[model samples]
Target: MQPYRPSPSPARRTVLRGSLAASAAVSLGARPAPAQARSGRPRAAWGVQTGDVTSSSGLVWVRSDRPARMVVETSATESFRRPRRWEGPLLGPDTDCTGTTALRGLPPGTQIHYRVTLADPDDPRRTGEPVYGTFRTAPARRRDGVRFLWSGDIAGQGWGINPDIGGFRAYEEMRRLDPDFFLCSGDTVYADGPLLPSVTLPDGRVWRNLMTEEKAKVAETLDEYRGVFRYNLLDHNVRAFNAQVPSIVQWDDHEVRNNWYPGQILDDPRYGEKDVDVLAARAGRAFGEYFPVRAPSAGRIHRVVRHGPLLDVFVLDMRTYRNANSPGRQADDTTGILGTEQLAWLKRELARSRAVWKVLAADMPLGLVVPDGAVDFEAVAQGDPGVPLGRELQIAELLRFIKHRRITGTLWLTADVHYTSAQHYLPERAAFQDFAPFWEFVSGPLAAGGFPANALDGTFGPERVFVRAPQRANVSPMESPQYFGEVDIDGDSGELTVRLRAEGGTVLFSQVLRPGRVGQ
Candidate 1:
């Protein structure tokens, strides 16, 4: 799917308005059927979700128990008796047999009830039962008091002795928070649902395929990426969560192939990866179909949305433009987390924003490093499993930019590296490393894995100045893998309180971030 951009023609608005006027409560658009009618249950599919809802439109997504055309409708309220809506019949092949229809003419800052049904393209009488859900449009430019959830790295199904660790339990707990939206930092799915796949080559010989690009990008292949998303979305808690609220999503490596960088897919060595563009194209297609994301732009995951006076969120594409992790014992200063184009766009957005809080919704950590002032270029070069390389330099530039523009009310929220912690960077400090104090809160993995106790103890970076001297500011509390992070803002006071919660609504950690705390 092509990236979403408003049409510029004078008749563009007329076309949109006309398309939105097809029906009172529900309307169907022109859609051609797939080559064959689908019959049989989707390998792993369930859940009715809404994504990328602007003041006037939103995307409705679902997969049927059986391959059939699907219809989605939206209404102004729960009792859809009289409401504006949009609907479309979908063919179940190109988009993983899943359907994503766009709903238009929705009012801003309002909640609407929606339903999805498996329909028969030729005979409308034979259709599956409709599934009901809810969604909210983005608030108007003058609105305020918005809230959302941010977390990452959910545990997936078990393999051998390795148990499943997913956000199923965490999501259940987050339901109580009633966030308007949620952001996944990455690793949202475990490709190894039944367990990591052990591939037997074309020659009956066995090989391990992480399902990275090489193994699955061929015209026909379903590896970890597909399997993981299948299983993750199947979780009742996840489906229920999505059905209840709209989500704005972007992916990390797990969504495609694990530990993938800009041009490389971390697949097994035996299989040759498909061309980068082809593989990336497939991954993008699958992700757009499964998640409620706005269509992607050039296989890149970066976009910005303003939620009235409450906030301005910039979702980044860290994996698409990164330099190859760091090669051996060297730092690739030229490598950037945000490609030059994205970086330029980010600067302009940052300078032009008018919201009270501007959040950089990063998929990886932006400001944390090894405590001993050491850089593990080897692990980085090899594309270490959990380390965030190039983040330091990214933060350096980000902090400098913030300082230069004198932007206020800024914060960084990220996932990946499946743990919870918060650190601040201040570049004006007396200590060389503490010269920058910008706060970052890292949250992830609804299910914790073998992450060691206090793993970040001595790993605090110099950017942080502990509220308590001598004690580094980078240390995080020991918490369950089943945790979610939240940002609750008190608009009148201009105070933002971040809370880290465990399953069952347990508040494990909390911090209050204020204005003028950075670059002081």
Candidate 2:
């Protein structure tokens, strides 16, 4: 249970004036609220997180509230002195009390400092009261350059957490861009978007919503998808951006409902579980027992997350191998969306990558066209302008095997069509061009509700150049502004630079590239 390496907002005001930083989007503090135990301990109140990491290993989530025992320690300083304990796992309820701990060796790009506490599984001297966090550990040196922050939809459609604007505040604006990790890039949760403790807004405002009872609906049980992953840890900017970022999480199809595939069958009556593979196997075992990954299988997510010699990050779980939603002009499909053994394990991990930025990440949005309704097709360009049909013939066989294996620095980050973009693709503006010319980009929802900006499907000819969306559709997040995506790289100019920010981090659009380039 503890083997495999491992690895791995609240607010106030405003003050964003241009080109990136000057700070002041307010409230990046507040983390109290689990006191009053005095002695009988066993707490952890939803905080400590870290994931995937690599280089020397990582991982360390926590969740307790009872039956405790997780212990974790680690330290590179935060005054933890000679630390490095680890032990974790036992907070039961069959994974509801959540757990995850792996640590191992460590010391790659430095700065670790963990914590966690929680004992009392029968009184090992009653513990609890630790919780701190910190990350960073991938660089083995390419001159140590790489940064992160990709986004995802969280608490969607009915948009939860709104402590008068101090909640899920775009995860404290991508945790003040401290990024060493965080890719999420999917609908982390929206398990069919529920919530509602107030709404009204068509302009009259109102919004509100902090709801819980499994977010007031839709998540069909496995403890209602572990209470929608403990409802974004009741946000303090998503637990202070999971205590200083370190994540690689993946999953699309709203984490379990909208646009769900893999033998889908629910005609949606708000589900009594008309089997969308039994509500995606209880929302993928409550999203792998609340996200520190490993031990997943139902609706299995894809893998690869290297991060060292300058990024690898493949991630993609395009909904557990697919081929459902229709109208994608099936001209003899072969499980189109990454299905045949995850397309031969992503063409054998992009032909044994040696890292220099591969990052396919993607959870939808190949060329956008998203529809799933008026005729099926829920992603991977089904608005076909001809040629490659059905999930663009498995992304045209992984872009003709990365252009006949000349693979170099791939790229293609994504987030389900919720705004922010940058396409590019070409082979002379394709309709099925055999490949070489990349860059996909696309940002996200971070704190849900923002739509508008979908159609582009020229069977991968792409070329959007840069978008910013929201002219309507769901909107609200105090009326639009919450997208992410930022890259960086550049260790003596291996140059990657992406940007596309917003919601106080601003930058709105940027591009860069260069590094054994294919399309610039």
Among these predictions, the greatest TM-score belongs to 1
lDDT of each: 0.56, 0.77
- What TM-score fits each model? 0.74, 0.36
Which digits, one per residue and each the tens of the lDDT, describe model 2 over residues 23-90? 11212222222334334676666676788888899888887765678998888776688997978888
lDDT of 2: 0.77
Give per-residue lDDT, candidate 1, residue 109.
Answer: 80
Each model's RMSD to truth, in Å? 10.7, 19.9
Write down the worst ten-residue block by lDDT for model 1.
22-31
